[model samples]
Target chain A: MATAVVARPVSRTQTRSREEEVLVWPDLVFIEFIAAMLFTITLFLLSFLVNAPLLDQANADVTPNPSKAPWYLLNLQELLLHMNAAMAGVIIPTIWLVIMGAFPYFDREQHGQGVWFGTEKAVRLTIVSAVVGFVGTWFLILWDSGKIAFFLHGWFGLSGGDSLRFLENVRSVQTQLPWPEWSRNITYSPVNIVIIGEDFQHLDFPAWLVEQGIPTMAMVGMSAMLIFSLWRVGWVVTRRDALIVLFSAFVAAYGVLTLTGTAFRGQGQELVFPWELKVSEGIPGQE
Target chain B: MTQMQPSAGAAARRIEHARQAEARKLSRRSFLRVSVFAGLTLSVGAMAAGFLGFFNLRKPTGFGGVITVVPARVPKAGEEPSRISEGKFWLSNLAGAQGDVAGVGGTGGILALYWKCPHLGCTVPWNPAFNGAAVNFPGIVGWFRCPCHGSTYSRAGIRVYGPAPRPMDTMAVSVNSDKSLNVNTGVITSGGPDNPLRAKPYSG
Candidate 1:
């Protein structure tokens, strides 16, 4: 059993004073309420100022040369412009979120005590990582554009100069049929994907089945397996929470995908269908 | 005597230790409050700087609003000039006008064309300036090319290549009775095969 002990003064005994402390809750509430209202009003004004630009109407028949996505998505669209779609669209966003969520877990530190950088080595590393991520992505995009232009001309035989000529020739000349007919069967076209089974498409599908499908399934399976590991992590450092991190990551990823499609892909532009091309040209020899 | 002295010393040490622990707890609390405020300030500052840098990138340059072109005297039937580059402004003749000049019941003869790439707002410079080497592009020459991004347009300003999403816009032209070309500021928008500005032989 523990006994209560009173402390005696080192010198002569001195009398102590007692005071009552009162918290001003009303004042705190008023300040908080004001702040929240001001924030809402500011955001409303800001949203009103940011008017979005609309492109010309979407037509399936007339494809615009070098069709571009909206400005907000220029970076991602630039990625799509240079790299493969799947890599730019899905894999990059997933990687970004995974790294961000796993950060504090990987960097456990007792040192950073009260400083914002918290004498914690992990906190400092996070700041550094964020800077690196931003600068690295910007530099990577700049380098990609210049390097990509070469491939456009050298390998693809598609120069910004030559593509116009190619389209005109392809449009006018008929060697049994137009180039679109020939390209229609080549099978990267979405028309084939919805119409025919995966096996029926002309491209290498067995490889897509093994490489893409299997890995995607494995990734989902691995996430399920990690639940126990994640639970254990959350159990420690009672202050550590997982729901906010996981949910935030999911929302970020979903936002990126939605923004990518909305900002980059034109809604009504269909690459398939030749009938739409029959608009209003003159009959040859009539003039 | 020895046991009494040791007990007395232990009591003194415990009192000192308790006082120090209380002091440490208070300091840690103060430090935490300051740190949170500082971290928030830094994060906000960084985000603001990032957005500012992204928004201020360089804008593109464009040419004068209007460009005009003139075809030769009387072109033979079915004969189109491969290139039209000489005087006031660079223009590529898109299509020949039908009918006779002075004869009644004639639809009037005036070359129909315009000179601007509807995409990216860049001037579609006529490439006829390039000699036969650049011409006869695979036995057939294209009309205009964009120096900025290599967008090519036919004599009709139809976007054939590069990043332009639509055909070139047409300058409104009024051929005076004297046969001199007068171009208006208005540009006729052309797109697809049905675009009213499309030239003959190319319209679907």
Candidate 2:
């Protein structure tokens, strides 16, 4: 008996030679070098066209009316206008960074790798998130600035004095929550409540708490509501899609806040038209 | 059958060796590529970080350090505050009674007042219009006026009018052996009802 060897058949597609092959040296490196050169040229042109203005030397005694943080940190500074400084400056940023870092773990899919707006669903989610963030932040800023609040107050015929009296009375109460006399009495201490507490203290802690709490609650509640809507609408089928929506929202909100802080805030951190801003007496570098 | 089993076992061992050799070669190539990329990234990152760090380096002479404002001879008793641009402050020569209230030393005390307004930190300038000759201030001469807000300070750096919560802040002043005024910008004393005058008498 004679032994015979068998061979597997090759398909025409497999046999065809590749027309293009990507190599890192010239393909990727050249593009990178060109991009870097263009960026440098742009920066050089900007330096010549725009002169960086130096304000009068730092004077500790005379702080500018609307003291502002650096440009990158303006988002937090803008948040400071609506909420507690610790929450805006520390808590929010820390949470954002941690979430961003953990995004990769949540989005473990190999599908749609290295593609912008990877899927049609992703693009829609991003657009929806961005719109939600932009409109929400814009409304919050206007509301916190007393622009909308005062308008509605007048429109509703609510007397400013009555509103202030109500707030004062609520603040004077010993407990964190105004209702139930027993809760107030239980928490009350003669030395701490009357002296060290917000009752007689120079700084109005109760007023600050109420002022800061409303905006904080609104921000958190709205974000939670958005996520819940996405889940209920079935737009967020996967963790990757959910992350895409959240990341886009965060980016949009950050951009809006930075723009607002840089151009909108004027004397006393009050909202003003960019053209009407009196930079001479306001924040440094604005002038 | 026993002889055929040994031959089959040897063939299997030989095939495993070839596969292990191929894997080693592939891994070696990948390791080199990864290391090279990492090195490039790290060097670029380090250079960029170094460039950015340069901007944060501060000089030893400015805001937080001591600066010599002016010589003692420039400011005369009951005269206007001599503005020193370099030190960003005003040097005033007050009478002994005013100095006593200001907490300064010397026959006629010397006080260094920060040019910044106590209200909102705007630069305050001595307005000659509000001097004794002017009727607006009523017997006040060489009063400091803030351009931002209408906070007015008397010659002694005391807040006399407007929304200023307290008097103008003072810096520690020392007289050198050469009689030049050395203003310690580092030590800032807040002006309030309890300590309205925070003047450090020039010690020669």
Best by DockQ: 2
RMSD value for candidate 2: 17.2
Candidate 1: deviation at residue A111, Å?
19
Report the C-alpha lDDT of model 2 over A13-73, residue by residue, as the tens digit.
Answer: 5454565655558777898999999999999999999966744444444455556777788
Candidate 2's C-alpha runs over 4 A off are A1-56, A153-216, A282-287, B1-204
lDDT of 1 at A130: 40
Question: How many pairs collide in each candidate, listed in order?
Answer: 14, 3
| Each prediction's fraction of true contacts recovered | 0.00, 0.03
- Model 1, span B79-143: residue lDDT tens: 44322222212233333422111111222222344444444343334444322213113334424
User: Measured against the native two-chain assembly using Cα atoms, what DockQ does each of the candidate structures obtain, in the order listed?
Assistant: 0.02, 0.04
Worst 10 residues of 2 chain B by lDDT: B130-139
**Model 1, stretches more than 4 Å misplaced?**
A1-287, B1-90, B94-115, B129-137, B193-204
RMSD after CA superposition, every candidate? 25.6, 17.2
CAPRI grade of model 1? incorrect
